[model samples]
Target: MTERESSRYIDATAADWIARLDRGPLTNEEAQALEAWLAGDPRRRGAMLRADALSLLSESAGALAPQFEPTPFAPPAAPPPPGVSRRRMLAWTGVGGLAAASLGVLAITTQPAAAITTGLGEVRLVTLDDGSTVMLNTQSGMRVRYGDTVRRVELLYGEAYFTVVPDQRRPFVVDLPGKPLRAARGTFRVRKLEGKPVDILVDQGGVWLGEAGTADAVLLRANTRLVLPDAAGTPLPVPETISTDHVSRALAWREGKIAFEGDRLDQAAAEFARYSRTRIEIRDPALAGEPVTGLFAASDPAGFGRAVASVFDAKVEQRDGAVILTR
Candidate 1:
């Protein structure tokens, strides 16, 4: 990496570092120094704050795995002018921003807002200024901010697909605090797993993965998977035989239903509880021990109780809106 890129990495790490420090009491001098560092740049403070949140999300997502894609990973919907977007685009160049600026400055305005997000079970489709689209999945949120120098979207929360317009001049960077940002020059899928790891899958072109310190960046080619953490960033090998088939299944929740193939029964109940307003309680601890794996849609607790009952040969009773299950 060049000196400029090195500084950028440091800038990225600053957020996660400050957040780590904030957990402890700092002396007045330490606090003052921090204030100075934050004030040094227009982007410093915001970057640091985002770093903290990114760390937490990465950690949480890592804890859960297998299938892990949410909604559709679409390209930015807004079209970039006659050329490649980021190697060249950002939200500063989009519809909302384009209206205020000349067509000459369109892509500049739309770049940042390219990273979009959605709420629980809520799927969002966003058009980027470069004409690429993003389909955001449920219970997630993120910020897309493009710049003249770089196309950067801070994955504040959740995941999205980025079909870059293909510009070699500027790279598309997906920023997640505590994790090395995924710099894409082409097309790729980056998903955040709560409490576990960040999964980057490249469909076309490739991506460059780098940490916040002195480390060589890893290049992930097409049809590849790379797992990483936010705080302790690392590029892990994705076995060719172990590609993620679960990404599609995990994302099935966008339409409703979680696909589990012989997953533990208790674990299933906990997941069901998140989607169903009426909790699905397992009265027996051993019930959680039983393995359950299959395709089950998320809906009425009463209905799920029936499904669980039939599958497990267990007892299911509905009290109020909650479904109580036992083996």
Candidate 2:
């Protein structure tokens, strides 16, 4: 095969692997095959991350599998083919049954609770028995456990955007590392920061943040953001009210892009690391603190690293599967 054709074949294979992995657990043989493919070529790993096709497969894991395509997995909802509206497409694909089972519209009480996780650069949408929806970011996972009196979800790691269905009879709460955010009705985003506190952004309704039994708690209303306590159990400051614009920037990863405005280089790299295997190393501590601003594709850390290198007149090198930047 020609060089370009060979590259395209590898990319397509990586995309297919991602779709298969997203469907659920992989068999032992499948896992080994995937590892072998990734080990064959370093560039193949990048192709895998950029594919990130799980989010598209999220809606039709089993029954509707034939109807949904994962080839071009772009976010923010692409329009259906020329004559088809999204609702009609869903109806035809048989998504309603799966969605119903997820949202407790069906008798999910007899079912076992399962955790959902997304691999690097992958995004997944999960619906709970309580009718709540969670959009998990790359390298994220959560556990769902519901009971007669309470609906609880544990954010094991990473970030997720939640859309809740209010249940006055049973409060819905998300448990983070240090504390839990309880809500009777609301939509919010929660991110578990590495080596720091969990961040909560409430877009609608109300959220109560604190240790479940503690008297010292805070209320988070619409358009509010706050850092919850650290693992050390440090206290949180008063939540800050934010504008819709700020909220949009924070959640821009949902659209397959990361938006930054006057953010430090180190911070930007950390954000990018969540979506790709490409490691961004700032060899110069001084350069790490330099501020940067822009929007870049979440799956293209090499491009972002090059952009930073150009802006700062630094050097970009690839070593040991990592992108290292130096001045």
Candidate 3:
């Protein structure tokens, strides 16, 4: 086959893959096959990106078609017939004018940004275009913005754990109210709660905390935790090196459980309130300060309250959608 024919074949294959992805996730076998095909030729990745750009453009045009009136001289263009090639579709849609180098830019820019939210007691997992996954915690909201040079997510409220895929060209950055956290390849968790300082934990790889392309950015490595002050110009504390066990306990919310290692009763109750509508009320100051340690279901506030009361030889009362403990 001629070189042109080989290029056309690659583009067609890429178009088919994009279509499959649009329908839904590919099966494991299909995913493996796609990996193998992409590994076979470096140019195939570029072709895939171009095809993806054309597909996004086509979808956007179709969605906006009803809003615009056709030109007086030009009647509405008819849809392409069955078996019409993606190349022909691009030409018909006037996307052929786009330069090849700009395909990646167009693909990222033309797509609309998405805001993902989770309700109280809800945990959601989101998959991005580049295969990175964001696991949103309870009452969390995040906005996704993919640009030509960077993949950015703004954590508007609540907590989320990000498992970012490595892209040296486009660094993955998660923005909080304060400094942005940037990573090339890493798994990290960021929590922003009301009246509390932002908490960041790096699990698998290192993440830079601060503005991008700046020397002042602090790198938080694996098993490191940083508590960022909410007030601007507050002296930043050193990133603390935490044990693996601490990381696991901190992340127990991911598994629908909350782990407490000698946490005060009031602190544990407040943590439970973040996960459940059923409140745990400890009226006595002494009882509230009692130390509690264990793993308990996040959703079962009553069960947790009962266990605490039993251990402390206190009384348990259910009232007005709350679990109360008293001596």
Candidate 4:
């Protein structure tokens, strides 16, 4: 295809198609057309997914911005038959809050900055104007600031996985607890657990870790996990290497599950609490260090409680919005 032809159908067209699909069940003709368009170009599918996901997230958050209608692409050579006119096309494609996600995707892309937060047991996916995507885990918050020179994000709390689309001129930087993590092209996960060290896990590409003001930095490559120094500024005794299996286990939360490998019972309980309103308490200190293994739903507090109780024959009590276990 010629360069002009390739550039003719861009993300804006894809976004319009996404808006249409989200509205309602489409006619077979429309459906076939969409499928053909998607199959025609690989990039089109990616654009549609990003736009649709972003719209969903905005809808879920109860904040849909005003509709943004870019200039519609030039109408085809021949107008549609009797019922299906270009006006009908707009009607089918117009932003409808209930029919599908609308307004927010356009707003986020054009706005200078935005902030997002997810409550307990909630996961959010965001598509930035730069075309990067971010998945926010439960109880996480972040602020995005985009400019001509940089695309910046401040991870206020909790964990987020960034799938960055490279922009060589504008570097993507994530601000964590102690240092700034920068990437031009890559996917990575950054986590900030309460009272724990900030963790950076690189799944694809690489990240530069360093203070916000200085030039000194550490380059961490793919499949590597780095745990920064503790609050006391004490580094690890030795460089820690995380295995692929362990990385997968840590990221299991993305799938609404948690993997435990001989994790302390108390520690496991704490992790589960992040995804549920009901808290877990171990009354007996002796049982706090008990080993726990296997995979379980992040929000299944009752199931976890029952499993623990059956294993240790411990007493399980349901208190005011909390679960207490003891022997």
RMSD of each: 17.8, 16.1, 17.9, 14.0
Clashes of each: 76, 0, 0, 0
lDDT for model 3: 0.70
Candidate 4 ranges with C-alpha deviation above 4 Å: 1-112, 211-215, 231-239
Residue runs of model 3 more than 4 Å from their true location after superposition? 1-112
| Root-mean-square deviation of candidate 2 | 16.1
Whole-model lDDT values for every prediction = 0.51, 0.66, 0.70, 0.66
Clashing pairs in 2: none
Residue 72, candidate 4: alpha-carbon lDDT: 18
Writing each residue's lDDT as its tens digit, candidate 3 over 1-327 gives: 644448789989988976876666555576667767765665565566567555654532111121122121222377544443433322222222121211111212222367777777777656566656666778888899998899999998898887665667899989876678899876788998888889999877789999967866788998999999878977678999998778877876765677787789999999989878889999999999988877677777887887787778889898999999999
Question: Where is model 4 poorest over a 10-residue stretch in terms of lDDT?
Answer: 95-104
Give the TM-score comparing model 4 with the true structure, all chains together.
0.66
Question: How far off is residue 40 in model 4, in Å?
Answer: 10
Give a tens-digit lDDT track for model 1, residues 10-100: 5566754545453554455655565566545434433443343233333311112223222323445775444322111122111111111
| RMSD (CA, angstroms), candidate 4 | 14.0
Q: Which pairs in model 4 have colliding backbones?
A: none
